[model samples]
Target: MFHNFLVTTEHRDFLRFLWHEDNDISKPLIDYHMNVHVFGNSPSPAVATYGLRKAVEKAETDVQDFIYRNFYVDDGLISCRTSEEAVDLLVRTQRILHDNGKLRLHKFSSNNREVLDSFPQSELAKDLCNLDLCNDTLPMHRSLGLSWDIETDRFTFCTCKDKKPFTRRGILSVINGLYDPLGFAVPVVLKGKLLMKEILSSTNSLDWDDPVPELFKKPWDVWVQSLTELEQVCIPRQYSDHSYTDSNVRLVHVFCDASKDAIGAVAYLQLFRPAGPEPTLSFLLGKGKLAPNGGSTIPRMELCAAVLGVEVADIIKEQLGIPSECFRFYTDSQIVLGYLTNTTRRFYVYVSNRVKRIHSASSPRQWTHVATEQNPADLATRSVSATQLSNSMWLTGPPCEILTKTLPEPLSCFPLVEPQNDCEIRPEVTCIKVQMDDVKPVNHKIGSERFLRFSTWESLVRGIKILKQFIYTFLKQSDIDSSEAY
Candidate 1:
């Protein structure tokens, strides 16, 4: 529930609205002028919604908090732990939206029948009933372009790929249409992004419907074919929807890694059941990005991956309402691990900034190393078929038994390279002054000069004369010896 419920009409008055309709040869003409801020043009929806948010924040505290956290544009969405709380929120939220800001919340659907009981039948969604109740199931409910099967409690994807002409712009449109906010499709979607990057980096700019270049033909076809298999994929909608009757310990495992092509991170929830001897897991969310055309080193990209991992962990903590201390960060990069653990060495600007972000999000001690072979984020950085992703341990989380045990040794022993200080060290310098009249000249050879204020030419001449005499004596002795021997 959002609009310009805050913006004054005076502020909206300055904008002009105009249109015209005229016949060619001396016929009638009509011109229309818009009266009440009807301009809809914008690069961002913020222009329309931000004003209402500000007004609500200024007056209604509860409404502001809920809308700020849950609302997008005119739609206000939220979840509740219990049916009572949901009904209360629904009533209070409607009152706030109408009273505080002239907004009406509608198109509401909920899995809990009790929550939707108070609403008029006409106002509710046509097919919002429980599917488990009968063999005939309702179609999937949609929000933010992703489909949710309320009956099954799962996030389902519907893959509909028609044989359309493939081009850079078409690829971009399709990639943009993939509403994977949770990044379950990151491994599959990243391939398309790489192709787009390749096209943009090329010498020619391609049209929206132009044929895919010969260069990208094979990879593009393989990726598009894999897209068809995405219909089979279904990730658990909730990280921990079921009761953990047997398990008390819960941990969040976030993995980070980077390849030459890209960098990525993924967060997963591990539910340990000591009695069962095998804990269960659920995929939470993940993130990925292609290497910029400008390029970066693998170590730098690894550091970026760690930063991404920390961000994902922080978001998961906030969304799941989990304790920060329980979060653990994993990465395959030794350099990143060392950077987080090393307190003695300093890093260059790029590494230092990213390391700072990682530390601020989670403690360095929380960051641990996982073997490259075991890192799930590798699937995202490198392309994978949809089949691989659907069957991959990456989406399902690692087998809980093996992933929880055998953690790596601490990274303190593997510190980063010691940083060198560039500024040079200089010896201390002193100046001394003497009066020429009171100074005494020093007598010394040039090679072994005396430390004095001044030296006279006479001392230098005497030293040279002594050296010449020693050389003459040695030569005369050698000639006499030779004559005696003959």
Candidate 2:
């Protein structure tokens, strides 16, 4: 087959020299002494030869050793391309030699077919065969790769030469199939893809469709439905105007208590007048001790505190010339409430008697219990920080300092009221002196007098009145004081 090609005259002469030793053309011809030799010269020989020579030169020593070690036969007399191929050929040649009686064949008995049949066939057997074909055809099938054979129940992968696989189901399908027998409903890839696409499409359109507006409308519709249902049920309209002849009639009552741990404890004396805003009067009765001093127990302290608060209200009623019957005391404490409400308890009996005495002395009053949340004075009974105490004081009344600032020059000349105790009176004297210094002299004379003549006791009395008036005015300005402060 090689001899039909045209050759140079010198190459023809060399070929004649090579053929002289070989009469039969079937034997592969080789010559050690030949000077001219060309490699891979059938077609595009130059490129092929150059590539092959480069590959061979670049091959590692270990690879060359492996090829020589595995393929060597008869101490390098014969060689083969691979160890497996050489082994197979050796076995075949030996078998032929044995059959000719040049060598003896070793005989072994096979196991029974029934025994072999007892073992189950592996599921991978068909897959292995399919894998072999897939590997063989991969180079040709570029656009359309072979798919896994579902009918054969084989789990195999396919590859393409250039283009990506088209017909082949991915690893997800194989996993789904394997899990199917285990009763798990693994999601189908096609179905999952479709669902994902649908979700993506919806998400893409969300902005354009104004989904937020639609979402808002749903809640609005629900609200409308709820309102409609509410409308179906009859509800009485709130009366804007209510009439009452006696504004002095009190309705709400309060009682309060405190312990040594609670120093600035206060309670409310709420008087719910029919024709006026509820009169919420707050009174601070010192509660909780700084140190253990022989004093009333928590309950007794509470009762005493309640009494002190009531006494304050009475004093206010007298000082302001308001009727006592117009006030109603409120308390959350059951003990205090019992003392005021219960006629049977000895202490309550005493309280009732005292109340009767007050009523006889002045006018009748009411007392009642209130839920703690509604009782504003509950805050005072609890332990409070300085800030909280200041805030509560501001809410209840004007601070003494603020009152001093707001008072008229004539009113500012008055001395602060002092307790009867000498120890308590000394602090008042100091505070009054400081306040007197703070008061600036008025330039204008009143009624031809350079300054108003004032006695110390009279000044103290007037100072108390001015402070009380300032408290009322400040309370009127604040939201927490309620409209009753007027």
Candidate 3:
């Protein structure tokens, strides 16, 4: 694939290499430059991708769209409803890339035996090349990190036996090695993450290569041993047997919850078929994140989980092309439900910002309350073993009761805020103005004569000065009256 694109003359300088000719050390080293993008070159992927897209510029709309959306570097993955459609798409894509860019598109694998029969065995994946499609069962193939079981058409997990030191780095490597982009194993993997967090946060700081504390050793070993059970866990690749567009009603339910140790959200696709007696429910995605350090209230943690639920729901909605109105959000915590459904109450900064995010993507009418035991996201916020995860409702989807039950009356029916104490609720403060009756000023003569009216020394002095002024005015007027009488 990389050899299909020729490197420009100016850029070939960066691809120059020194080589010894004919294994003769006596001879001077020969400098050679690569004319084409080669493997191991950093720019090869981008260059090849651009070249591939450029080659298919005038191809069929479907082919162009598939190339643009499905191709990851060299490999292209897509799903089709019918075996014929799959075969046709692969054939056309292969022919277009080969005719235009001289690129070979091969090693194709599909769950349908008919689809494989349409292509030559030489072009099939290495595992399928020698197999007799008629006599043998299809084998498991790894696609984009996830193990694909073509026989069952389901995605499965396999654990690697690579042993590493039980140090911080080793533990982290084991945790990161599990590539679950769809979050199928998030709950199980979350246990390992929490364990690593505990080890790193020990009172004494430990280096990457340093051994973890002895106290955490047993739990770490237990987690490592549990990986073997992951092979038992498998999820359907296709959401439902029937196409969602054919269904009578399609709904997306997202459940979010939080625990002291973690917070998380899980989404499921519910398809109501017109003819089928019961609706089909499938797990779409699951996400588990550790709670913020320094402690957080359950309500706040639950709020974080709600935000995560909205994000997960958005992704599922966009991928599934489901309408936002058909999506509903569930939370076990009434506080979170209140936060999402709140219309009149103002919240503190933390709750306000998160509430705004939830409201922006979803409406108050879309959120409703669910009992704790019924919430599938509960598995995400807490630790669960591989066995539990394989059998947990988190994978199989929400409980049967939830699947059949009607959605509660819109957010209007639910209480806006809890009657009891809630920390997230911002206290409402009111300012009231009182109009006191007017108090008339005291007459100077009356105030001076009544010494008891003056409480403080300053008031008494003020009253005395007022009395002296009054006496001087009266005396001046009396002198005039006396002189006139004489």
Query: Which candidate has the top score in TM-score?
Result: 3
lDDT of 1 by residue, 1-486 (tens): 223333455554344434344645455555443333344645226754775575466545556777787777666666667789777777777776667656666667776666666677655676753333334454678867788776676777876566655776667776776788989889988888887787767726656667776887787777777787887788766566544443578788888888888988998887776566555688889899998766587888888888888888878877667788888777877667777787655556777788789888888777777777788898898868788887886797765554666354565655654324211112234668843432433322232334242376787667667767876777677765532332
Q: Which candidate is the best by lDDT?
A: 3
Candidate 1 weakest lDDT stretch, 10 residues: 418-427
Better by lDDT, candidate 3 or 1: 3
After TM-score superposition, what is the CA distance of residue 62 in candidate 1 from its true location, in Å? 6.7
Question: How close is each model in CA RMSD to the real structure?
Answer: 10.1, 43.8, 9.8
TM-score pick, better of 2 and 3: 3
Q: Enumerate residue pairs that collide in model 1.
A: 1-74
Q: What's the lDDT for candidate 1?
A: 0.70
Cα lDDT of model 3 by residue, 1-486, tens digit: 898899899989999999776668888899888999899988889998999999899999999988998889988889888898888888898999989989899998999999999989999999999999999999999998899999999998988898989788898899888989999998899999998888877825778888776888898899999988999888889998878668989888889999989988988888888878688888888889998676588778888899999999888776767878988888877777767766777887998999899988888777777888888889887768998887798898877687556475566666656634777677776868854333743331243346777789899889779866876787777765532332
TM-score of 3: 0.83
- Model 3, C-alpha of 380: deviation from truth (Å): 1.3
How would the candidate models be sorted by lDDT, starting from the highest? 3, 1, 2
